[model samples]
Target chain A: MKIAIASGKGGTGKTTLSTNLASFLAEEHEVVLTDLDVEEPNSGLFIEADLVREKDKFKMVPEWSADECILCGNCQKVCNFHAVIQLGEMIMVFPELCHGCYACSELCPTSSLPMIPKKMGVLKHFRNGNLNFVESRLDIGEEQAVPLIKQTHKYIDQQFDDNFIRIFDSPPGTSCPVIEATKDADYIILVTEPTPFGLHDLKLAVETMKELKKEFGVVINRFGIGNDDVLAYCNEEQIKVLAKIPNSRRIAELYSQGRLIYKEIPEVRAELEKMKDLIMGKMKEVVK
Target chain B: MKIAFTTKGTNWSSAMDPRFGRTEYFLIYDDEKDELSHYDNRDSANDAHGAGPKTAQKLFEFSPNILITGNGPGGNAATVLEKTGVKIFIGAGEMTVKEAYEAFKGDTLKKL
Candidate 1:
């Protein structure tokens, strides 16, 4: 089964839950956990594994060639991003603004604009026994993350078959990156805190998930501390509550120390078990 | 020489918008012809991204010799504007279109 653990607000235990759950699941079945948060990937911190392989990821951007020289200004007209523009006798291509759509390059009458691969980030693969962990991190100063995330998904798709139980740790927010990470997952586990901030962002994530028409459930982290508004909201929406990880000082302490809490904390382990069981119950053998 | 001022409105008395990418209007003052013209930039609001570059592309049609705004164009927009030889003058914060034009004539606005 393909599952994506996501949260709308940052610092709501996406990495913590992913690392613990993937590690716990790896004990019995082969599991692949890929971190889709290209900007900042923290799952590697808690995962103790050997380096298996690594690959550089790139995205295509248009390059202008003055040699081909037909100043028809077609590239500028076709480019919806405003990445390419014709100014007087010169044509300029902004690599940062280019969405790699290839509209400008493909439609250029002179073939002056050619698509070129630009290194955007690197993906590292690590393994420990039955678990395979892959994390893609974008180069600093990179404005876009969706392309890198897309490439990461491609890497995961190529490396693992539908038989492998794949889990994705998605980025925060209901924006492009989040959507790209969870689009193909068979089930999404929305991790959320019980505070007002968490409730608001969770509503956004819920709307986005509903828009995508994907199967999903909720897991409320630090449940004992914040108000019951998040739970109340989830109840009203008729979404399943997969598990509620109670507020615990030990869980926070272990997590802060870069340790996976499932092995040490009984409460966290029970929550993980509940989540795992719920996922397993609804999952099909080839669900992806 | 033609100068472009990002303004809140078309009139000379209108305030110069501090924002370049999402400016309401671009008021052009033709030094040679002593004429005034304006382009509505309200359409930029619909752009999800690249507003700066889109604004620069729109301003390019006016072929302004200089662009005077509160904040200068960004990296992408700057590249397009620079190649077209549009000198940028910034730090015209909260100045009216007419006042900013006079400031440019007096060489007071900071050239970026």
Candidate 2:
């Protein structure tokens, strides 16, 4: 089953939960942890794995050629992105604005615009025992994270199957990147804290899931610091509180030192076990 | 000669809006007609993406020979303006439309 651990607010223990859960399950099952947060992938920091393979990722954008003797404005009209514009006998293309839809290129009578591949990021695969970790990092100054995230998803789909437990560490917020990461998820784990900011952003994420009509549950991290507002909200909304990882100084210290705590901390490992059981139950229901 | 200024209001004394893409008002001055008019840019102000190119397209339709603003247009918009033969003069920072127009005439403002 494919699972995605996501949070609307940053630094909400998504990396913490994902890394621990993946590692804990890898002890017995084949697990692949793919970080879809291309902008800044942090889950690999905690995974003690060896590099297995790496590859470059690319995105296609139109290149406008002023030659061929046609002054038609068709390129700009068909380009909904405004990436292509006709300017007094000259056709200009903005690579950053192009969505690679190929409307302008396919519809152009003169074939003045040709789509070309542009290097956007790199994808790396790592392995440790039964666990496989994949990370995609966007090149410096790259603005669009959705394309890289999509490419990473494609890689995961092509390499791993339903037999291998897949967990996607999604980027923060309910933006386009998050939507792409969790769109095909068999189930979603919405990670949040007990604070007001956490509750507010969690509501936004909940609304987004409702819009997408996906089955999702909540995981409360930093559980001891904030009030019970998050739990109350979840109860009122009929959402399950899957697991809770109490806020601990030791957990933070070990995480800061780039160490896995599930093996060292019994309570944290028990929470991961709880999450594993819940996901296993959901997977059975899905198969039924 | 026709000049366009990204401004906060409709008149010559209106304050210049630094950004070209999301500026509130675009004031066009036609030297031959000696007439000034305003074009509202708020239609695409909340646009999700490509606001720069959209604003540049609007400026292209106006057929201005010059554009003055606090900050110049971005890469995408710059391409459109450059292809359309619109000479962009930036550094109008915090100047009124009348002052900016004088600065343009005196060649004091920097060209983008």
Candidate 3:
């Protein structure tokens, strides 16, 4: 079953939950963990997966030929991103703003604009025993994450097996990258805190999941630090409360040191196992 | 020479808008014809992206020789305006469109 762990607010322990859950599941079942947070992928830091392979990610950008080019300005006119611009006798192309749509090349009357590949990021494959970890790391100053995330998902789809329990650690917020990560998920575990900010963002994420018609449950991290507002909201919305991980200094310290809490904390491990059982039960119901 | 000013209102008395892409209106003043006109720029105000170049394209349609505004045009918009050979002037923040145009004529506004 393909499951995604997501949160609307950042630093709400999504990596913590996803990494621990994957490690726990790997004990008895084959697991594939993908860090879809291309901007800042840190789950690999906690897991001892050996880098098996790597591949560069690329996006198509317009390359203009000045010799065959007529400065008709049609390319600039058709470019919604303003990536292509005509300056009198000169034409400038901003590949950073280009969305790789190839509309500019199609609109060029002289056919002087050719689409070329530009490096956007890299995808890495790692393995440790029964656990396989895949990560997408975007290059510095890169604004496009959705494309890289989609590529990473495509990689997962190609390599995914029926026996593998796929867990995707999605980026924070209900943005395009998050959608790309969670679109194919059979079940999404929405992680959140009990604070007001967490509640507000969780509501946004819930709305997004509802719109996408995806089955999702809530996991409240750092549960006792704040009030029961998140649980109250979940109850009113009829959303399932999968687990509530207590806020502990030991876990925080372990996390800060890039250690998996499930390995050291029996309580966290038990909660993750329970959450896994709940997800498996839900999957069985769907299969039935 | 035709001059364009990013403005909050239709008239020359309106304050110059600092944002080119999200400006409420663009006032075009034709010095040769002694005519003044306004184009509503509200369409691009809530644009999710590429508002700068889109607004620059709209302003280019008026064939303005000079653009006076509160802030410098962004990279994309600057590229479009530069292609059209339109000179940009900044430092219209505290001045109304008419006052800014006067300052431009008086060679007081900072050229961008």
- Candidate that scores best on lDDT: 2
The sequence of per-residue lDDT tens digits that candidate 3 reaches over residues A1-288 is 889999999989899998999988898878999999999999998999889999999988889899988788888888776677666576778777778888989888888989989999999999999999999999996777888888888898899775688999999999888998999898999999999999999999999999989999999999899888999999999999999898999999999999999889888988998987886776576555
What TM value does model 3 have? 0.88
Ordered from best to worst lDDT, the candidate numbers read 2, 1, 3
Point to the candidate with the largest TM-score: 1
Clashing pairs in 1: none
What shift in Å separates residue A48 of candidate 3 from its native position after superposition? 3.3
Give stretches of model 1 more than 4 Å off: A285-288
**lDDT per residue (tens digit) for residues B52-84 in model 1:** 888888898898999999987777777778777
Local distance difference test, each candidate: 0.89, 0.90, 0.88
DockQ, candidate no. 2: 0.67
TM-score list, all predictions: 0.95, 0.93, 0.88
By DockQ, the best candidate is 1
- Model 3 spans with C-alpha error above 4 angstroms: A66-93, A104-110, A282-288, B102-108
Flag clash pairs in model 2.
Answer: none
Residue B6, model 1: lDDT of 94
Model 1, span A94-155: residue lDDT tens: 77777899898888888888899999889999999999999999988677899999989888
Ten contiguous residues minimizing lDDT sum, candidate 2 chain A? A279-288
Interface root-mean-square deviation (Å) of every model? 1.2, 1.4, 2.6
Give per-candidate clash totals.
Answer: 0, 0, 0
